[model samples]
Target: MPSKKEIEEVLKLDAEKRFSYTIKRIADFEFVWAIGDQHGFANYGDDNGNVAFAIWPFEAYAALCCKADFANCKPEAIELDFFQEEYLTDFKDRKMRLAIFPLPTDKGILIDIEEFEQRLQKELDEYY
Candidate 1:
């Protein structure tokens, strides 16, 4: 668990840094956090019809967004391998985007699924 100050510091980072942080941390931990309820996982949709599935590198970080649109949801951890194999394929098929490290106030980084996958893959590849 991250301390309050650490969570605050991470949240204070700019969107780009937050995105990079999410990628690196998820790669390091082999899991990502997302908010969901009994119905299904939470997501944001815009007028343009692009749905964004938000993820966080830490459970504490993900807990911060459980208000407003996600008030009924709770943070759930998804393994990196399952995310890469199952969710990515479904996301690509649906043309969904990824919202990296979203906060209560900020929307974090909105990235295309394929591009986000590529970035994560690169991080994984560099370690092996």
Candidate 2:
């Protein structure tokens, strides 16, 4: 398990290695400013091993939530809750989820990353 600082350090290193891009912190976690897409979410860890932040970008609106992860992951995983979209309205002002899993893998081919990303990009491109 890595401490929050360790995770941040890795993220920083990853960012430094990039040729060009900008990532900033919204509340506690870092995120790359996305122009017109909600392709995926950003997961960030803190110096304390007890907490993490999940970032969601919705049609230019960003929401941040803090969550607890008993399973410390260097690359924070993504997941979907067992509820409907209405459930998200309840967390419009929060930072964490009751559960988190590796995203895209939650559903079948239609809802997987490959498909979902395509839809997101097509939608986001319209804004470009």
The prediction achieving the highest TM-score against the true structure is: 1
The residue-by-residue lDDT of candidate 2 on 22-71, one tens digit each, is 11221122222211123333443333432222323221222122223312
In terms of lDDT, the poorest run of 10 residues in model 2 is 18-27
Write out the backbone clash pairs for model 1.
Answer: none
Write candidate 1's Cα lDDT for 25-83 as tens digits.
88888998999999989997666878999999999988889988789999999999999
TM-score of 2: 0.23
RMSD in Å for model 2: 15.3
* TM-score (C-alpha) between model 1 and the true structure: 0.94
Stretches of model 2 off by over 4 angstroms after superposition:
1-55, 58-64, 70-110
- Please report how far candidate 1 places residue 37 from its true position, in Å: 0.4
lDDT values of the candidates? 0.89, 0.27
Which prediction has the highest lDDT against the true structure? 1
